[model samples]
Target chain A: MPRTVILGVIGSDAHVVGITILEQALEAAGFDVVNLGVQTSQPEFVAGAQDHGADAVLVSSLYGHAEQDTRGFHHRLTQAGLGDVTTYIGGNLAVGQDDFAETRETFREMGFDRVFDAETEPEEAIAALQQDLEIPLTETDAEEPARATL
Target chain B: MTRDKRLPESELQRIASDLRDDWPTAEAVEFTEAVEYHGTLPAEKRFAEVLETADRPLLQPRAGVPRLRDQIELLEGLRTEGGADLLPTTIDSYTRDNEYAKAQEGLEEARETGEDTLNGFPAVNHGVDGCRELIESVGAPVEVRHGTPDARLLAMITFAGGFQSFEGGPISYNIPYTKRRDLAQTIEQWQFVDRLAGLYTEFGVTINREPFGPLTGTLVPPCIAIAVMVVEGLLSATQGVKSLTLGYGQVGTLVQDVAALRALQSLGDEYLPDDVTVTTVFHEWMGGFPPDEARANGVIGLGGATAAIAKPDKVITKSPQEFRGVPTMEANAAGLRTTRQLIDMLLEQDVQIDGIDAEQEFIERSTRALLDTILERGEGDVARGTIRAFETGEFDVPFAPSESAAGQVLPARDDDGRVRILEFGDLALPDEIREIHRTKLDTRAETEGREPSFKMVADDVDAISEGRLIGRPDGSNPAPSGGDD
Candidate 1:
């Protein structure tokens, strides 16, 4: 069975296109994508992951409040029996844009398996997802290799 | 006479009562009395005075902290170092979202850390005296800037607390900052804010009301932004607001950005009420900035030059920390100093570009068509017309998340990096206007060797600071100054 991935723009943010593009790309790469659209809450994300049996929960936060919005998100997922799922986040993840290093570290310590920088190419995240999932490389995603793991 | 949207005397009294009851300290003073004390001040002290002067672009930096003393110090730092002609008190996100409790918490945290945990100052939670203290501490005209959709108490407190200027509008503020808000409701709420300004006007005080421009602050077509401004300006004027300042955000393409500012001021003078004071404000690049501080200064410098050439009444400065997070007071002043230097230097130079008239004319025609349709939709009642226009697809804003916005329009940049509508979507502009955008986009599509897609829009949105105006199909980017042709 194809690996299942759940994606959405987390928090009060409604920047939908970023997640929409990611959803389309994931589907084309043969991953089953359950897109929650924008303004998704932690409970909603957990529910989606549970309903879809998602192996990964990809969160896109462009408005810079994921720190507050996802403070205990990892713990909550663990509470809901999703602690083992791969977690990812990308896009203007902080309020202004300067604290990429700190933001990534904080999120990683918060239990995110991988944290994509705001400027990280969408494909880079995709390759990381494929590699982290230990999925065999499909011919379409073989041209570009994923960078070193975070 | 144009339909007066002013609240009746009884309703106005009731509104005031409820507002004051929310904050008893406000009830201790009179609104007119506050304006009387704050309004006579110079531009350095009274924001409306900034509009009264037209000799040079008044420079302002967005700086806010939770504590009154700290905020006062920050403003002083900006004034002493940045040489800011005007200063801002950007409200925290919690205050903006009407979460007063959260704002209070953030305030406590900020007080504890001596570092603001909140992104901005919480004027609402600080209440009347808090706002008054901040206003009194700063010699420069202090204004409130926030993305609040329902700013009822904020307006009452700030205006009564001695602020002579307020920013935001039903469409511009709501469509861009908020994800889910009813447009008609926000418009009506803003009418109250305007009516508050109107009341100040009745008392011989002129509070400068600026409609937030740069909806989405992305790749918005100038026509769409101008249409929203005209509608809001007309709506505010109908409520007896006499001092209105129009604003436009810089979009990186120098010619197009200058044309956007020029079109805004001209159309304001032409389309808005003759009785109102129509001035222009230029917002330095509201889009994404380079994380590199050096590159960001180049972006801010270009914005300053654009403002000087565009001849706006004032320019809002962006700091070097724009990309990372809330900037330090030092970064804010640094940006203002750089902007002042640029503006002063450009004032002596001609700074005029050839081939600008065509773009200016294009902006004018498009804005005219947008306003004409909106006015026709409401039979000349701007408030009613605005609601009707948004309900229909006639007044669409590109990439707006508001359920009230049609959000059908798609804008992209041409080979010359000027913003143009790739998909007009039911804009109701004349065929000729649509044809112009169609041709420009088609020409760009031919050069890019791909159909007009969202990829172009996404790339164009972040093209600035990457050293170019046009976001090419490929991920390859040029140096910061590579955009200079």
Candidate 2:
């Protein structure tokens, strides 16, 4: 079975392009992707994972409010029994160019398994998802896949 | 919401009253007194007249802050330092989502800490008095620019507060700006906004209603953007709005952007009632910007050059700091001046590009296809047709996050760097039009030595930001100087 992954832009940040591209990338890499779009809350993320039996949840934010928006996100996921599902956070995680190393460290401490910067392309995330999920990196299997739903 | 029918007078009043209660500051809205106050403002402060009478493409910058004093100071700097022809008071996101209490908290925090807590001015939190203060302070005409799906309360307050022009419509604001808002609900809500603006026009204030043109602000095909503009324009005219400025965003391709702008104005006039004077606004590249300031300025310069050739009525400027969230006021003014320098140098040169006519013809034909499908779906009612078309995927915006849209259609740049549809989804365009797009994209695929696929679409999305118009594969072309990492 194709591995399932849930993707979304967390909090009030309405930026969707990054996640939209990432969705296409991961789906092309053979993941059964469910994109939650933007302004997605932690509960919504948990519910989406629960509903889809997702293997991973990729959180994206571009408005510099990710740190505040994801304060209790991992705890909520753990409470919801999604602790075993992999979690990834990406995009402009902080307000300023205050070293992405620190930002990545901060989100890693918040319990994300992997973190990506704003400039990180979709391939990098796809590769990381494959590495974390142990999916074999063969030819891209996406054949003009249907638009993602839910 | 059922059909594209005008809201009755009684219904307009009922909703206006209810909207006033969304927040306490809304209590200060007095229609008759507000009309009188609008009469007191000078002609120079009128948005529609100033825009309509302009001899050249006027420059306007997007800017807003939490505090009223700081917002005023910011606008003052843009006006004096940037030489902005028009000014915008972009509303905060909480206000856009109608989260007034949160906006109030942000406003209070900004006031106390002297740091911007909100991304934009929470106009609703400021209420009528505060909006009036902003209008009175800005020397030039100010437009209330926000992406509110339900701008009913905002319209009631901002209009009564003396701002004459407002940006956004049901589809333009909802599809690109948010998720989960029903299209039918927003259409019904924006009807109230247009109806109110029409009422003001009848009272001798020509409020300029501009439909947000840059839906998704990505590689939106020209036909799709222009069709949405005409649909919104027709809807606004139905509500008695007389002065309309349809908008088009720069897509980076010189020929295509110019053609799209012209098509937007022509189609807007052809579709809407003649009594409604139609103008066009050109938004500088709304997609991702190069992280480097120098390269970002190049993007802005190309936008100005296109505006000069297209001769749009107003040009919305983008700051070089766009890649980094909200911009400082100085950077905002600097962007305006940069555009101003480019436009002044080229506006009088009469430079013309080849193939503009053919490109414009194609755009017009495609736009008509979408509009006709929409009208048919509504069964002759534009508003009803719009809602039904979106529901059925007959009309769609690419990269839309809103649940109301199918989001199935995808766009990519052709070999010539012009945006073309990569995925049709359920859009209503004719097979021949689809063939044209397919052929252009196929040409691009041949040049790139790859089959036309989603990979092209993805590459095209980040092309301009990487200092190139087309996303060629690595090793085929080296990254241009100042390309973003």
Candidate 3:
């Protein structure tokens, strides 16, 4: 069975293009994607994951308030019995050009499995998902080499 | 199921009173007193007059801060240093989402910390007196620019506070800016806003209503953008808004962008009521900007060049620091100056490109197809038609956040770098129009030796930021400067 992933833009941030593109990339890469669209809250993310039996939750925020928006998100996930679900967060995660390594560490401490910058290509996240989910290389994945760097 | 109809005067008043209660500042929004206040403003402070009477395309920059004093200083700097012809007070996200209490909290925090906690000026939290103070302090006319689905309260305060120009419309603001705001409700709310603008105009004060033209701010096709602008213009016209400025965002391709702007102006005039004065505002590249400031300036320069050729009534400039969330006031002013320098240099030179008329004609035809479908769906009412079209996926925006739109239409650049629809999911474009787009994409596919697919769309979305217009598989064709000739 294909891995089910819950994807959405968190908080009041309305940026949808990145996730819209990412959702297509994930689906093409052979994942059962549950796209939550934008203005998705923590409860919505958890509820979507539970309803879909998602294997992962991919959260995106481009309006630079991701930290504030995601405060206590993991706690909400754990309370909903979704603590074991693999989680990743990406996009312009902060207000300014702060050190990205520091930003990654911050989200890591908050229990995200991986953190991606705004410029991280969709292929990168897809690869990371395959690795974390233990999904071996399939024929299609081999035939079409990941064009992550283009 | 909301029909496009003008709000009754009694309903408008009752709604206005209820909206005023959204915040403590609402108590200060007295209509007649506000009309008298607008009458006191000088001619230059008026948005439509400044735009219409200008000899050249005027430059406006997006700017806003949490504090009123900071916003004044920012506008003043943009005016004096940047030579900005018009100024914008971009509202914070909280205010745009109608979370006035949160905006107020942000405002109070900024006041206490002496730091900008909010992304934009929280006009609602600032109140009528605060809005007036900013308006009085700035030399240029200020427009309230926000992505609000429900802009009733914002309009009530700003209109009374002496702002004569407003940006955003039901479709433009909702599809691009939010996920689930009901389109019909926003349309009804905006009618009240427009009726208020119309009422102000009736009192001899002409308020300019501008529909936010850059839907989704991605690779939006010119036809979709133009159709939305016309619909919003028509809706505003119905509510008695006499001064209308339809907007178009720079699509990175010079010829297509120019053609799109021309279509927007002509079609707006063609469809809107005769009493309404139609103007066009060109937005400097609304998509992703190169993180590098120098390359970013190249993008802005091309937009300036396009504006000069298209001769839009107003140009909204983008700062070099766009990759970052909000730019510093200095950077914002610099963007205005950069656009200003380019416009001044190219405005007088009669540089006309070939194929402009043909491209514009094609855009007009496509726009008419969408408009015709909308009219057909609405059963002659634009509001009803827009809602129905969107409900049925007959009308769509590419990469839209709103559930109201199908968000299925995918746009990719052709070989000549024109935006072409790669995927038309239930869009009401005629078969011939779709064929033209498919043919264009097929040409591009042949050139790339790859079938036209979602991969192309992905690369195209990131092409400009990566320093090119078309996203070739080999990445061999980097633009010599800013991805344009």
Candidate 4:
């Protein structure tokens, strides 16, 4: 079976458009996407992942509070016994001009497998996941994958 | 509880004293005097005066640097090279979110790099003196602009530092800029900010406070924007703000933009106390920018022309770098210059006003109705009424993250690109006005031969950059819909 990925804009961020765009890009690249939409809770992301046997949890925050919002994101995934799922965090991650290296390190320590920026092309995210998970690059899966609604 | 009253003199002093005690007051005083522009005018220069005196729309651009001295240089460049009528010190993200420790850290980094690492000025770290220095360095009256929900400390520092203008309100600042922040808590903190301005009013310093008018800056209907402005105006007036500038963001259509400005000014006059003076400020497009700099300039030029023909007292300019990142000083200055030159030329042309158009009446009627409902909901107090309205969806913002907001009000552009509320949620608009929106949007949908749905809304979200107003359902997908996110 192809891998399923759960994604959302974490807590109090209503930047729905960016998430919507990412969802389309991921689906076109042949991943079964379970989009939880905006203002999604950490538990919900975990629940969406567990319910769908998802391979990843991608959290997006654009309001510059991603540091605070995603502080316990990975911890919650592990706490919920979904520790093996590959995780990604992206967008305007921090408030000020903190070095991106520091930002990447901070999230890496928090257990995200890969961090994507708004500047990070969707193709890169897809390619990285494919290489990291050893998934087939071709769209060999059936076209009609079930979309899990939150 | 009563709706509005000035802070008691004793409370005001105690609050100011407590606020001062939280920071280094002695150093704060030095920063204020360092400002070369501090009290440079024969009379105290106030933000309201610039708007009131301008025969044509005055231009202001957002510019800030982490270091105080760098910010001073940036503003000077904007004034001399960019011809800014008014100056703004946009606060950094850390300060906006009240992470002063990080802001202080950025301040040091900026000093070392000689390049600001922070997005805006760190007013709190600069203290009263640092803020005053920036205010004085600018030739024109300056305003502190930030998207802060709890702006008390920042307000105290800047106002004492000699900034005579402030932007933001309890509802406007909280609902749009934050998520999960308690509505009542932010409102209470802002009451302190407003009361501080009132103390200045008693001291005879005519300070002006503006409520953010764009609210999420994404396809907000005219009535939704005006209703919030008027409510915030009334809230500030009760706190004894003698001068107020009610602001509105442009919605990319000409007549609708004009009508929104007129309605804001007229409504401010009507709702606020007779003694409180009111002016209108128009914002250029606050949403997404085209990736191309040339196309972005065209978008900005449209805003300038609209401001000119609409005859707003002042206009806020957005830089071409809006799509990429924080604007460079040169880009910021370019925005101001383009606006100033266009407004100057437009002042000569005649776009004579006749009787009230349906757009104006519709906006005015909807605003009045919403305001009345709020007053009724609050049972006379705007503060209480606003809380109740927000809780009940009587006042809701489009695309806002606040749980307090109903979020049911969906907005889509009509054929002409004027934002029309696709769903009113719980708004108390007159039936006739609602019909006007329905017909306008319905006609557009029919022309495109598509059902009015979220797709059109999505397309309209990207319409400006694509060089179209209405997101017509031409076969081309606006980035291909439906990942179902």
Candidate 5:
């Protein structure tokens, strides 16, 4: 089975750092991670996932504009032949001044598979990817052999 | 407790006394002349003396009585020398403008004679093209000026202060004999004559000239200073250039009261070019050492009430503590929130505004957070720990001896186990206790909307060892009633 990817920045209203961090983290996670960095337009994200044949497209935005920026992004992905790809997003996705629950619901309606708040740990992200991939959590052998493929 | 007001005269005397006490051997000159520009004997005599002492060889010839013609000659000579350097450097590399035109000219000549192909891989160009395409794709607001003359003349009026400050400091300081006249001429010729006027002809960037004042002394009048700043800003915007920014020190003292704000507003209204925006700097102390009642009155007593009356596009205000250097996290958080509030308020007033977040304050807070983590946990425990060693205890010292001594002692550990003392002064507490205090603050900030201050996540094992409660569940807890037996 293909490995699942989970990614996003963990902060508020500063997207530039988030984008760069996500790109580096996802590549190191042993999965084909299509990272849609900060202030990314919805269509470009969908295109990136489709082009890379990615199993998942992870979105990270730190700016409070994520609510506006990420609105309808999932639907756009599906329309762009990336419906099979799972979508993940996190960070201070909404302005801190308002109710985050309502904002989360709004994003859910727009088709996000999972939503994490600003404080979600990286380990939690890794666990989520394992669960999403249906990998056995009990596979605790001392070591696993690396698969070689051309 | 409220602090007593320090009178301006007393404050000046105190500063002078302090300087005298610090530098007993050095000769200190005291002048009581009013801060003004041009024509008066005090200013004229000072300007002549400055020119005569200039370090540049060419400027020595025309070092007295800066008439327009004399000013023109001095400027022309500098321009010719500087241009020789500028043209050559531009041809050699795309890095940035050369400080000296002669060096620039040599590089340009070398590039012309050198055999190097400009062609490169198209893919790299494609990537650049892609980035540019992305940037352009993001639609931005278009700014429309009334006309080119309005823009250009307006530029002159704006930048007059920056020009004056850039020119004034060197002369006032009496830097060196050979350089002073040349520097003054360079300021006049390059910034004023060629760049401002020539840009109008070459780029059709119009600039307006209002009646500027005569130089009375070292200090540029507030009105002219502000106008010159505006012109510099306009030129920068038009030329797509950025200048080394200058700080407005003690601007609070200059425009403290409602009367000062009103006067500034009236001057801006009367002289500011139409279609240009104006702003003012106001200093207020929210947290830190309490300002004297008079200085405090000069600040918060106005409560932006005067700002409301002035109705400038923006008003930048900072606490006294921020100016002094060591700003607390709470102060910074408050300041950031206040900036957001101010921006909102200005927007409500239908004004376009941008607030400058004190970079030093932000860096200090962020550094403190990192420092707290390092002092508690040691290196490799947190990401921000790397920058912790850079923080010097001497930074908090107001006087030279204390600062120098702190610098010497702090970088090296004491013969005893303890690190050299922290520079928090009265605020200093036990390092161990401060870490706990900072941890609580960091925890609150993390749980709240703010980002976690530390670069690395707190160690859960260590936290548990330390009796800090974490929410991880163990399977030994009682099963639910509906669980299978």
Candidate 6:
């Protein structure tokens, strides 16, 4: 069975464009995408992932409140019987001037398997997912290597 | 957490006084010019280029005709035979008698003439109506304000929070608050305003929809603030609101320069009503300058503190807890303490105002103090120190995360593929057109009050666009050139 990815905006933040773009990219990359539109909750994300038998749950937040907006999703996923699924988060996560390292750490502690900064390129995220899933990279993926390659 | 040692009382007092004095006068003068400049241009020209060049189709006509017809072979066969002449002589006579051509011509003429009407007015009206509809749909009240000073001040306050964001950007703070959760709270505050309006309407008060903000931040795009106001004036005629109060807070230094101020003043003379009173609120803390220089600029002194500067009647202060999305008990406590100190200073100034009392227990409870240690030290320190402070209970208030409160979470996937948010900045207009309108209106409004005829306003705006002005006088001279360009 093809691995499915559940993706969506998880709060009252209605920033739809970023999520829409990501969904398109993921689908083009051959991932069966379960896109929950804006204003989604943690439970909703978990439920969608479970229903779709998602291999991973990906989250995006542009509204700098991602820190407070998010919770222990890994634990929630485990409770929902999907602890094996990879969890990913990216965007302008915290509000104000905070260290990205500490922010990433905090999110990691709260159950995110991976955290990307606000400026993290989309290609880097895809690469990370491929690495974690042990999937072979495609030709289009080679065209834009990760930011670290540059 | 380290705190900066307090400056001497005398020095702080002097600085506070200076900031208070300088801030408002500068803001008032700058806003006055912004309103006046905006009013100088003919509304039609203000947005014509945008409409003509707009890539996205804002307007398109749809076809209404239907397809398909019933079979008329039997009737046609009868007509083709001997019955053909018996069908339509009476119908032809009736059709010939009708004067459809003349009526259609008259209607077309009216529409053509209406098409020449001011551009800014229609566009702004559309935008405002759209905004109002959005707000109302979400259960919020719409407040529309007219006149220069009021609009300018309002623009300043709305833009002040993001003053740093506008520098050198094509669009002034082009980013919409819809993306920022903290800024979104300010927008959401309109719901409270709507509730208030409803409460007042029950008392038979004619609740005027005063236009606040250039609120969406896009309220008036950068450089087109004046144009937005002019369009607003035209919109107000139908809206039935007479007076408008313009509020000015911390607008950027460059945008509010002398030239911009003059432009605002000219725009005001052309568009705003005579009775409209402009109020300027200069937050002393905005300008990072010595108190003495700031004082000369008419900044309202809220004691010696910047935060204490007088808040507007409808003040929207961000709760520290709300600022970063999570409630930081220490941050909230600090914010409240700062707010209280500022409020005390404002009360001492004896300024008359009514709204959220800074001293109220709820206000105090809701407000957090200035996390000076965190804010000054920067985000990394704040985030690190915040966690430490929360764990140790070193904060004045204990941390209690709201369980039921909806968290502002990010989506794992974005609809727009791009990680960043899209922004549409300021609207552009020909500089020559703006200048010409400014000169004509400024010359006229200084001498003539509200009595200037609409034709005169239009003529001045036209001449300004044309760069033709005769007898343009010295500074402070209110006379217009009598000669045609």
Against the true two-chain complex, what DockQ does each candidate achieve? 0.15, 0.37, 0.38, 0.11, 0.02, 0.03
User: What are the chain A TM-scores for all the models, listed individually?
Assistant: 0.89, 0.91, 0.93, 0.88, 0.72, 0.86
Q: Give a tens-digit lDDT track for model 1, residues A1-150.
A: 688999988888878556645664576566788877677899999999999999999988887788888888888899999889999978777765376688779888988988887667666777888888888876334432121100
Question: What is the Cα-based lDDT of residue B280 in candidate 6?
Answer: 17
> Which ranges in model 6 have alpha carbons more than 4 Å from their true place?
A1-40, A44-56, A60-69, A75-85, A90-106, A117-123, A133-150, B1-485
How many residue pairs clash (N, CA or C atoms closer than 3 angstroms) in each of the candidate models, in the order given? 6, 1, 1, 4, 48, 91
Error of 4 at A122 (Å): 14
Runs in model 4 lying further than 4 Å from the true structure: A1-7, A11-58, A62-75, A81-150, B1-3, B25-41, B353-356, B475-485
What's the CA error at residue A140 for candidate 2, in Å? 5.5
lDDT of 4 by residue, B385-456 (tens): 888888898888887767778776778888777788776778777788888888888887878776565556
Better of 3 and 4 by DockQ: 3
Best by TM-score: 2
For B260-329, candidate 6 gives per-residue lDDT tens digits of 2233334434445564322211222121212122221222222113323333322212222332232233
Question: Could you give candidate 1's per-residue lDDT for residues B377-426 as a string of tens digits?
Answer: 77877777777878888888876667677666767898888888866668
TM-score of chain B of each: 0.94, 0.98, 0.98, 0.93, 0.25, 0.24
Q: Which ten residues in a row have the lowest lDDT in candidate 4 chain B?
A: B476-485
lDDT of 3 by residue, A53-110 (tens): 9999999998899999999999999999988999999998988669999999999999
| Candidate 5: regions farther than 4 A off | A1-14, A136-150, B1-157, B160-485
Task: Using DockQ as the measure, name the better of candidate 4 and candidate 5.
Answer: 4
lDDT of each: 0.80, 0.90, 0.90, 0.79, 0.31, 0.34
TM-score of 5: 0.31
- Sorted on TM-score, best first, the list reads 2, 3, 1, 4, 5, 6
Residue B449 CA displacement from its true place in model 6, Å: 55
* Least well predicted 10-residue stretch by lDDT in candidate 3 chain B: B476-485
- Over A1-150, each residue of candidate 5 has an lDDT whose tens digit, in order, gives 445453433222223333433333333344555443333456666666666676766777665677677666767777887787777777767765567788678777778878777666545665676677665755321122111110
Tell me the deviation in Å of residue B222 in model 1.
0.9
* Model 2 C-alpha lDDT per residue in residues B1-485, reported as the tens digit of each score: 36677889999999988876789988899889999999999988999999999999999999988899999999999999999999999999899889999999999999999988898999988989999999999899999999899999999999999999999999999999888998888889999999999999999988999999999999999999999999999889999999999999999999999999989989988999989999999999999888788888989999988888899999999988887768888899999999999999999997889999899999999999999999988789988899888989999999998889999888989999999998898999999999999999889888987777777887888778777899886645655666444
